[model samples]
Target: MVVHSISRYLLIILSLFLFSLVIIECKSIKFSTSLSPKSLDLKIEKLTHLHFYLQAIIGGDHPSEVKVAGPNTSFIAFGTLEVEDDNLTVSPDVNSMTIGRAQGILASADQNELAYLNVLIFEFTKGVYANSTLSLLGRNQIDVPNREIPIVGGSGVFRLSRGFAITSRIRFIPNSSVVLVFGCYVLHY
Candidate 1:
């Protein structure tokens, strides 16, 4: 009889403990609604245009881009991966006013064509947008005269930025170097 009474008391205590835990968890839980830009006092800013040249020195003693991994293949090295810290300049010349660096990885994804999967970050170091960065993730077809890549996100003055960058190969040398011009149209707030 005493054992049965003790078991009943234990069961009641356990039930009370579990109920208290559930109540505590319910009190801690927070349900929030979605907030709008107006509620946050954020205004949409003006659209901005940025033009620059990306100078990639490929095969010199001080190359800006290098193939980190790839199979021993032909000139069009498919499945190859290259990492670059190319110079973003105002002009096509390597000695032009430096704006930033296109630092990222590019992989030859398409086996049939000259298409590269580019995952790059445009890190600005000069002018009004200094210390800012814009992330770019898209496919770049080298054979195309004008390739458009989407600018995904950004920081600093370019926070919440969305845009597209038109890339055109200005100059290319066989096994030497390549210079590409980028015209970026961005909208941010």
Candidate 2:
């Protein structure tokens, strides 16, 4: 009789445990966001990865906010500004940076070229990286007035191999004194 009673108790416990698990699993959820940009006006050929704080002087302010999408993935924006720091040199890790291939350059249906900056993921043991261009891509231009833009959809993943701080800068000289300073950064996985 005692053995039968023990068996009944075990069955009840197992059923209760399974029920609890089902309830928990049903309540759990997951979330995600798309990084594809509708439009990109700049083709940043040379990207110079700088210390988070050092980029401000040269117009490197990024996204206006930071967002958490998951436990391991988060979205944060650095500031945008342009600084002419001759002392600043290309990051040795990625010195020979090419925007067309490096940052994943691609063409849209409109024949508009788009470069994916955020998707450039690289694994680093905490070193610096940098790249530059003779001029920002002819078709793509960065206007300081347009402060915030989406980072997604491109030919390559520039900052995705590993988590690292990235700083992008551009210099443009028109016929006049209107020098446009544009830059931004991302702390991504």
Candidate 3:
């Protein structure tokens, strides 16, 4: 009877000790304040306007765009995904001044309309913004004129870049290729 009592006391003491440990751990957790943009000394320097053309060669022997995964029904079928490394040029002509490449995946997310969820990186290889990249994530309604896409972020000279790209279909060669003009207004440091 005495041993039983002792074991009960010991179990109760261990339970209390564990509970105290948990309380101590919870009390020791320090909550930190999130750093604000101003506290980080981030300043918006300039609003730069960039104009370029994206030539997506969808067909031919060496195409820049390829359908990666999708149903066999149609190209614009919902959930269809295509990957592209389209050339960025100064003009609509593919042979114009080569500046960069728009590399990303385009997914057909709309069933009723020809809309694509574009997640692209505009990688500049020439001119003043060489070696810089701007990330774009937005919906592109192909039928709409001047479809706007948000420039979420960037790297290199385009660090902390935020902007919108006005994209318009310049030319569309049926089953061959499509040329799009992108006019971006970016605000960055």
The candidate that achieves the highest lDDT relative to the unseen native structure: 3
Cα error, residue 181 of model 3, in Å, equals: 0.5
lDDT of each model, Cα atoms only?
0.92, 0.30, 0.93
User: Tens digit of lDDT per residue, candidate 1, span 10-113?
Assistant: 99999999999999999999897798878855697779999999999988799999888888784458989999999999999989999999999999999889
What is the lDDT, from 0 to 100, of the residue 80 in candidate 1? 91
Alpha-carbon RMSD, each predicted model: 3.0, 17.9, 2.7
Per-candidate TM equals 0.84, 0.21, 0.84
Off by over 4 Å in 1: 1-42, 74-76
Model 3, position 161: C-alpha lDDT score: 92
Tens-digit lDDT string for candidate 2 (1-189)? 999999999999999999999999877854755554333432433433323211112123441112222223211122221122222222322233312222212111121322222222122222333332112121222222333333332212243221223233433322211222234343222
Ranking by TM-score: 3, 1, 2
